[model samples]
Target: METVAITPLDTAAGAEQSHDPLRRQQAVVALGRRAVAAPDSEILLHDAAALIADMVGTDRFLVAESDPNGGQLTLQLVTRQRYGGNKPLVHHVALDGAQSLAGYVLQVGHPVAAEHLAADRRFQDRFLSRHGIQSALAVPLCLPHRSFGALAACSSHERIFDAGDLLFAETVAHVVTTAVARCRVEQALATERRLSAGMLQTVGAIVLVLDARGQIVHINEACQRLTGFSLDEIRRRPVWDVLPVAEELDLFKSIFDGLRHGLGPVQFESCLLTKHSERRRVAWTYNTVCDAQGEIESILATGIDITEQQKRQQPEETPDANTPAGNPPSEPEERNRQHPNAADSRKVPVRRPSPINVERRSRPRRSYPYRQSIAPVQDGELPDPAEFYQVQCNDIAAGGFSFLSPRPPESASIVVALGTPPSLTYLHAQIAHVTRMRKEGKWVYLVGCSYTGRAFY
Candidate 1:
């Protein structure tokens, strides 16, 4: 290996700068401003290259970088800026130290200043010889962890490169390295954000990210489907607006406001009234997001829709024998005041019991436990039972009904069975709308259909 001059490029370069270092100092400041204002590395590189060229009084500047891995022995001279006699005739070449001047700088991992290449044993690049570059100054753009690349200035005529020139080159290289580090961090953060958003959308639960003030910041796809409201429709709105039923609003407000005061990661079962004014029960896990100083920044709330699960667990109430034969069953004076997680019915209530939220639907609806077999109607007649598939019926009303299925039904109009085996009520209905939701770690669609009144199944 030939003996090449090496400079450590200590942090302080002001005292060692050429006759006037003010211009170089100003250049560093200007480059930094541009770096903050515009993060495009190429634009920063170009602007920086121009500034460095002006500082050293040379128009020949080239930036060379290796592959992303930087494990390769060769550096690729990707950019060349020429303002005079010779434009870089060759785009790139091998970085075997002797192949090109830029390549040698990267390998040395130090700044190099060669006043004369012909007599200099440091590097004998055919590129420098071919282009008649007699004077050169090279500096490595290095990060704390790894080597980035090198910046080089070449001259066709004889010129003496002194310590002052070396200082200027290193100063600019430092700025470039800092900018590169910043850009890398920003790119990594952006990638992480995209990955987080994708995961949220894919999860089988509702995810709500809220600000410190209990206002909505973001909501995932599961939330949108369950509430029938989109992010744009809910953003910056108080969490209570679309979430809590009117009766539970006061309790919800107390729990949420206390969250920011280091209270805790709370757990509760809450009722949500959807955009269609339908009620859904969700079991939630709420946690606080804190900053470095231990102050709450935001909150993350994840909930699983337990509507059907709760319904399946609750036993149907049978009418009392004491009631009059023709009279409707009377409402119970009180409900079991106990938490669902509690093993005994005598356990304490989770919260104060509020008046039950009134049903919003115009007509009363009933929940059916059994799956209903639905098949397309042909010529106003029910299809064969062999061609039918069962879908879980959610609730049924006088005019329409909703059901859960893995996918949408094949036809717009289909015959549906509403009751148990022998006394099943079969009717024809038209699909009205569809919504997507997650249940039990799987995706399912909720299809709403209206009675077509064409014929009975």
Candidate 2:
């Protein structure tokens, strides 16, 4: 089990006396080329250690890594072949002032040279004598803001390491440092990206990320489950082509436009046409992510698939079968309510209704409770009043209701007047569902709306 390095340390300790500047310059040039072409850290460090030992001459050459937590250097690569690569325990010891010179290089963040190790005040005389080392040179491995470790060479003879030796060693260290730093940064960034992607998938909600151009940048696993499309299937596609139906396209576009223009964070509910040709309702919370330039970079939307929740809340409110909201139905009415269908086929499946039997605020609550008026309603309550046409009524509930309109509302927002004339109760709602009726006849649009909790009573 004798493991050995490819390069062996020269035992001719006296050879350091003939340090050649030209040979050192050639070594530096070779190292510069190696730094650029070296595929990884281990290769770069090995070449650096070998070239230094060969060009400048060393009885011992090695690289040590900085351990910030332990405040020490951990010797990594060594050229001393005396015990082969399997040389155990002793060389791996932590260096303090009493043990070795690696600490001084790390602290000083520069190269150090000692012509006579025993005579140098900075190193212990007894320790140098015990290790049989007389002269040495060490160079710190430094970064832009911090020092990581050092590379060093030792000779058993005094005056063996000169100015030429120190300069050559530093050049080698420079090449190694730059390459190592780059690799370390790349490794850290790669790890961070993996963690980010994992966290994105960990979220249980449907996450849709749209770039500035309204392209689908990303969609999480929940989105795939709801829409029957994978990330690969929908990525980089236009949001309109992937998610929304034609009727919902323009509304989504306008909302995206406002969000890109600093609409801030908002919460709304809308329908998503899935890949299976099915509609799923989602309640979304949207916000924008901006770049360093303060321009809109992407829109982030997190939503929950509430189609089942809406379905459950629907049958609870049946037309004509139930009494008023917040009232208990009699036995006969309760039976009819369970059926969820009236005698008229048109009103049978219209649980998602528009403003049905809503009165104007001008009248009392009792005056307009069951008065089904065919009138045009206005969002009189807003700066830009939107005209809402009353459609044929169906059942009404506290959560949502359905109606038959002559045409679909331009936007999800609509106003239902509870009373008449000057004192009108305008209730705001968001269109949650829409179904097309057969043929182009009057009251051919079947619409369902959810209460938005905003009203002028």
Clashes of 1: 0
Candidate 2: tens digits of C-alpha lDDT, residues 1-457: 2243544435464354326566567768877876777456755765576567665666565666666554666664343564445342234445464456777666666788877777777755343356666777888778768665776676667756667777788888888898888877876676456436634754898888877887888887778889999988988888878887667666567667656645445455567998999988776666666643677756777778778877655322222221222322335443343333322111212233224354312212221124333232232234233333445556565344456655544444455554455655554444544554533543255555443333443
Instruction: Report the backbone clash tally of model 2.
Output: 20
Give the distance in Å from residue 188's predicted Cα in candidate 1 to where it truly belongs: 1.2
Task: Find the 10 residues in a row with the least total lDDT in model 1.
Answer: 317-326
Look at candidate 1 and give me any clashing residue pairs.
none
lDDT, residue 385, model 2: 39
Instruction: Give the Å error, residue 67, model 2.
Output: 2.7
lDDT of 1 by residue, 145-194 (tens): 77666777766667777787788778888888888778877766764574
Error of 1 at 22 (Å): 2.3
